[model samples]
Target: MTAHQNGNISAEVSDFLLNCFARSPGWQLWLSLPLSLFLLLAMGANTTLLITIWLEASLHEPMYYLLSIITLLDLVLCLTVIPKVLAIFWFDLRSISFFACFLQMYIMNCFYAMESCTFMIMAYDLYVAICHPLRYTSIITEQFVIKAVIFILARNVLPILPIPILSAQLHYCGRNAIENCICTNMSVSRLSSDDVTINRLYQFIGGWIMLGSDLILIFLSYTFILRAVLKLKAEGAVAKALSTCGSHFILLLFFSTILLVFVFTLVAKKKVSSDVTVLLNVLHHVIPAALNPIIYGVRTQEIKQGIQRLFMKGW
Candidate 1:
């Protein structure tokens, strides 16, 4: 098996070297410091949030249970992508084996969909709590959350499992360098000698169908919540409702906006620098994970008190 002329890439290439920030070697150190900080913050904050919810028996409701699910997802997302990125930055360990890359791709693809679905159902929980106060207990019971968890798992895993399988089947004759820090479906598939039209179509169409539907459902849930909040007759009731929903709303905004920007830039790649595109993709995983617990902690009183109780017990 002779090496190809272009960079001498072999037909038997077994690993991919991530060309992260390849255009700006000087910036890798600069990026590494902040990335490391964010990873640490995300890990600490999410762990504390999970612990707070777990130990404080009072916090064990459908709402907190759902929050726990998202927190765990955030932790998993960070652990999956960030440490490997940090290795690339600090230790120059950019080579990811074919098996690991696809496994990472599968987790990356599947978890995000699960997170979106979780956010949609969470919005529904808020709606039921505010709109139908009397039936909230029955509608948003532990049983209801268990069912939602099952739905989230099934909805994402079955559809996304094919992504890596299809990607792995492509014949990579040469050019095994992935320009991004992560093993995105497109980044890996584009390296193949085979026609990747099916991969592109499945990724684009399937991703939109999953995320777009969740966004639409989330929008409707919040619309009803807003209407219900406005009709409240009690003084400060509106403020209280806004206060209750504000953190979740902020989280949703950051989640959706970052994802939208990444998708847009990814499609219109010519307009954006490749480094900028990769940077956004990296931050999309870290920024939201770091901020979700902090926003909820700052705005939600119950969470704030739970943290305090945990700290007091530790002290």
Candidate 2:
């Protein structure tokens, strides 16, 4: 019931978990303000996109519907991390409870998995539109689309449950600095007092499946897309095709780099000055969450015009 004498950490990971970070940069909330401002901007843009899709019957088609879902995912993606991250910085509440830390990690990963699935679906959607244009309607019907969404949602739910459960068993002896700003799996695993060989292995294994695999598939999808784009009969169609896939591809690259860096930085011994890696790791995460909506919203024309129209109508 009481905190471990040395702070309730496991005998094996006691030192590893303790004092890895100094209370965290949660106080950087002041610094996080600029990032928050960016998220706010995204929130507005994504909200408009959602509203426009719902209001316009023409936009109710599968493509727009999926776009709206992605927008919602993007919106939640930012909200889940940024607000809590900012709060930690703003209110000086950086120390997350073991329970709370596990929870944050779970929620964050849940959305991340969702992003992976969304990206996959987006790829398939493009595949159908480009590879088989004539059959697109029948192939990607409403029922089919709903099934895809459900499948992705299910995928997101399953892996995350084990993370928190396995983590709950770890005991923290004192070293709980939490290397990265948030309680990422890599950093948290390093703090284990118990035999973490399995944990480490699992981290590496999961990274390949969950993170690495997603990146590979995304690239493959784009390869097909680029091939299709080249064969397009008209310049305008090709341009439009590139425009659509380009944004998702760029974001995919962003995630692939940052996430791997985070994984490596965590697994690597701290013999070298890891501050740079840690910073990169945080930026990798924060930037993507902050930039997803902005990048997509700015790049997508309909979203841009819709935002202008939404507020303009109120005026």
Candidate 3:
């Protein structure tokens, strides 16, 4: 009946019971309210942004195209993780089939990596616009966008395909309880009866490579952008240049900070409570998704005008 003894006999785990915020069951119902609100806001804001972009011909430029990709990724990421979390909170439905769990894990990993890569691309776009203004149009043309999209999809999806496959091959045995909201590779792999060294190592190494490189490139892009902006002799040029990148920097900072906090909390697990870690992990997904469209809508004038036009037409 014990976990190890059960594991010794069988290697197949049909389903998994997610241990989603089990410590404070009383607060879960109340917690679901805000989480549900975040999900609703993320879906609504991103959808409106997408629709506005689609309907407005003026917004068909390369920058908006990249924004559209970000919007779609946010929508997909939110859809992948939030509904199941809501179900766990509201109905106490935490059981997920082995296959479904792996699928969710795959989607989460792939979309998150895609989102990070997209942010790097967006930073590069900003750099080219600010640093190499003359070449911006020619460099970031439709063809270039198409190529970048292909790279994003291939780079993120291909490497992540093996994650779920490797996880599926593991001997899960009777340890079916996962100690988090989503079906992350680490969380599920921890339940395996077989050695999880490879899984842990892969996740650690892959995450650092993907996210680390993107962050470094994004930082370098902004560095050059800052250098270019500083060279302007015009009086208001600095403010104008900063304003253009303000929203992007804000969102990027929030995105990176929350992720860093989650990683640090995981490292300092003894100092942090499980509930706090779980809350951080859950919020990192939805909070960015909810705020991204709103930031771009309010900060970017083109998007604002597009929204107005969309509403006027609707009326």
* Cα shift from native, residue 73, model 2 (Å): 2.9
Better of 1 and 2 by lDDT: 1
Each candidate's lDDT (Cα)? 0.88, 0.66, 0.86
Which of the two candidates, 2 or 3, achieves a greater lDDT against the reference? 3
Off by over 4 Å in 3: 1-11
Would you list the rank order by lDDT, best first?
1, 3, 2
Each candidate's number of clashing pairs is 0, 18, 0
For candidate 3, report its TM-score. Answer: 0.95
Best by TM-score: 1
Residues 237-270 of candidate 2 have per-residue lDDT tens digits of: 9988887777777767765675677557657746
TM values, all candidates: 0.96, 0.82, 0.95
Model 3 over residues 1-315: C-alpha lDDT tens digits?
Answer: 223322343546688888787676776788899999999999999999999998899999989999999899888888888899999988878888878999999988888889889899999999998988899998999888899999999999989888888889988776778888888887888888788788777877898899899999999999999999989989999999999899889878867964686587669889877777777778877998999999999999999999998999892
TM-score: which is higher, 1 or 2?
1
Task: Give the lDDT of residue 6 in candidate 3.
Answer: 26
Q: Which window of ten consecutive residues has the lowest lDDT sum in model 3?
A: 1-10
